[model samples]
Structure formats: structure tokens, C-alpha cells
Target: MKLDLIEPNAHYDMAHGKPAVLEYDNDGSWLYRLNIEPEMGIPEGQQEETQIGWKCYEVRGYNKATKENVKKVVIRSVIDETAEFDLVNSYNKHVLGIAVNESAVEEYKEYLQFTEDLDAVLIEDLSN
Candidate 1:
């Protein structure tokens, strides 16, 4: 499955030109960080050295009229996919800089497992 990066909250901002972030929420956001050298392709199922990024924030569900709400989830960073690093496109791609979410952080075990699973599927595709 091709992954897509999801931008976080409105209050956040991207700075440093390196993709690092500054969070303003009282409850921290989960971050998922990845640094991809577009010019250099990554192996499937292997964790690459993509610049670290974070995903934080709770997706909540609330009653429409009353506005009563509850925190549904606290997700650390979402996946980052600004460029493709496949073999065919490898030569054309450039390893620019890295990216970070100014909004959130990742849940440790959850992020680890998520990345592992993502790597497995992506690797299989890359091999073919």
C-alpha cells in the first residue's frame, strides 16, 4: 500500500527548513518521523534513516448539538511520502532534507509495530 502523510492541527507550524516542529498543545501529540533520501532507494521491510517526524493529537467524537466530546485517539506522526524512492525512479529522485510534524508524537510500541508492518508490505512491492 502506498502511504500518505497527513498534516496535523491548525495551530502547528513548520520551521527550521529541516522539518522539525514546535507543539503548543497541553497534551502532547504523537509523532512519526521518517527521512528518505529520494536519490537512494530503501529496501523493503527495512527501516530507513528518514528524518524523524512526529504525530500527535486525539481524534475525537462529539454530540453535534450539545458539543459534548471525548478523546478518541492519540496518534503519533502519520506516514511521510513526499517522494517515491523506487529503483526505476531512483536516479531522478534527490535526497532533499527531512521532515517532522510540528503537531504530534507517536506512541512508542504502536509506531514501531506500525512501521514494521508497513515495511513488510512495501518491501514486498519493491522486490517485485
Candidate 2:
């Protein structure tokens, strides 16, 4: 599958806890696994905003078929989209056993679902 075909926010199975592998290609030459990764951090120029964080949705290509490998190197490309810092920080805080407001929780949930949907579309496109 072409890495550029992946959308900005791909939908995935949240119930599964992690983004599912969208595609795997082994054509005797190389192995490729495509999937979305949600990461937390402030972007380079936005580092001064301490209360803010970002949930970066990246389409990562791995050399291995599974993520269980000790050194999972990305061999293809990474397409990323950055969201509001508060939304990501809320999600991160919740994961880190911190308390967030009700609205923050809902916002983060919505963001996650949106990204998952994006993934679902990419997976379908690759299959076709």
C-alpha cells in the first residue's frame, strides 16, 4: 500500500486498545506494516505552552509484521496530523491517573473515534 494514501486521522478499534495494523505486504523483496500511532508531546516551536500537549496521528511503516519486535524500525514514511494540546493533554492525564473534567474526557473520546474512522477508510482503500 502507498503510505501517502493514508488519511490524516484514521479510525481504529478503540476497544482493542491500540491501533490495528492497516496493511501488511510481503512481496519477496521487503516486509511492510502500516498503522496509526497516537503520540503525546508539544511541537518544537510550541514548547513554551506547558499545559498543552499534542496527540499526533502518524501513519508509521514498520519493517516487521508485528510490533512485538525489539527494534521496530520504520522503513517507509510517516504522515502526521496534530490536534489541540488540551485535548491530548486530557487524554494523557487520564492515562496517567490524573483527574480531568467531564468535557475533556468527552473531547478526547471524540478525537480518538475520529482518528479510528480515518484508519478504517485507509484500510478499506488498501484492500481494494
Best by lDDT: 2
Across 1-128, the per-residue lDDT of candidate 2 in tens digits comes to: 23334444543333444533444446422332344455344656885433222222344444443333311233123212344566677777877778656777777777566556545544563454
Model 2 segments more than 4 A misplaced? 1-82, 94-99
Tens-digit lDDT track for model 1 on 7-37?
Answer: 3332222232332222223344332223221
Q: Model 1, stretches more than 4 Å misplaced?
A: 1-106
Spell out the clash pairs found in candidate 2.
10-115, 10-118, 10-119, 11-115, 11-116, 11-117, 11-118, 11-119, 12-116
Question: Which stretch of 10 consecutive residues in model 1 shows the poorest summed lDDT?
Answer: 65-74
lDDT of 2: 0.45
Please give each candidate's TM-score.
0.21, 0.31
Candidate 1: residue 32 lDDT (0-100): 24
Summed backbone clashes in each candidate are: 35, 9
Residue 128 local lDDT, model 1: 40
